[model samples]
Target: MQLTITYFALLRDQRGLDTETIDSPAATPAELYTQLAEQHSFTLPSSALKVAVNDDFAHWTTPLKDGDTIVFIPPVAGG
Candidate 1:
């Protein structure tokens, strides 16, 4: 299935885009992330990334459906 993926902060810089479309064979958020990271060579610790599905925060085991909007946010820091 095809899902829309959005990258924030450091992830966007590394990926060179804020949003993209990804195709995955798995049904959960974690699976999709694994697929994307492998496909794009994005080196990020899974524990350091937050995921949102369809604009709401989602757990790794959250089920994914066609056309779901998924956003990946990396850890943020401030002074």
Candidate 2:
């Protein structure tokens, strides 16, 4: 199945991409992230990030379906 992924902050800089379409067999957000982290060498672990599906906040274990748009939001430090 194919899904769209969006990255933010460090994730975007690390992967050198803000968005991508991926073909994956990952069943949940966590699995999908692990796959991408390995593929892209994303440094921060999922514990330091949040996941969203279809523009709403979602759990890491949220089920993924084809054409789903996923966003992995990393921490943003602000003063």
Candidate 3:
């Protein structure tokens, strides 16, 4: 299926882009992250980030479908 992925914070830096659309065989966020981590050499683990589907916070194991927009939110720190 084709999905849209958005990156933020460290993930954006690592991915070198704010968003991208790609075709993947992943069934869930967890699987997609693992695949992406390996492909992009992302250092942070899935446990260190939060995922959102279609703008709503979602589980890492949330089912994905064609054209779903996914955002992998990295940890943030500020005063």
The Cα RMSD in angstroms, rounded to one decimal, for candidate 3 relative to the true structure is: 1.0
lDDT of 3 by residue, 1-79 (tens): 9999999888899999999999999999999999999999999988888899999999988899999999988887878
lDDT (0 to 1) per candidate: 0.84, 0.92, 0.94
Off by more than 4 A, model 1: none
Q: Cα RMSD for candidate 1?
A: 1.5
**Candidate 1, lDDT over the whole model:** 0.84
TM-score to native of every candidate shown: 0.86, 0.93, 0.94
Q: Report how far residue 52 has shifted in candidate 2, in Å.
A: 0.5
Model 3: per-residue Cα lDDT at residue 61 = 86
> How well does candidate 1 match the true structure in TM-score terms?
0.86
> Which of the numbered candidates is closest to the native, going by highest TM-score?
3
Better of 1 and 2 by TM-score: 2
The residue-by-residue lDDT of candidate 2 on 1-79, one tens digit each, is 9999988889989989889998899999999989998998988999999899999999999889999999988986889
C-alpha RMSD by candidate, in order: 1.5, 1.1, 1.0
Pairs of colliding residues, candidate 2: none
Go through the candidates in order and give the clash count of each: 0, 0, 0
Please estimate how well model 2 matches the true structure, expressed as its whole-model Cα lDDT.
Answer: 0.92
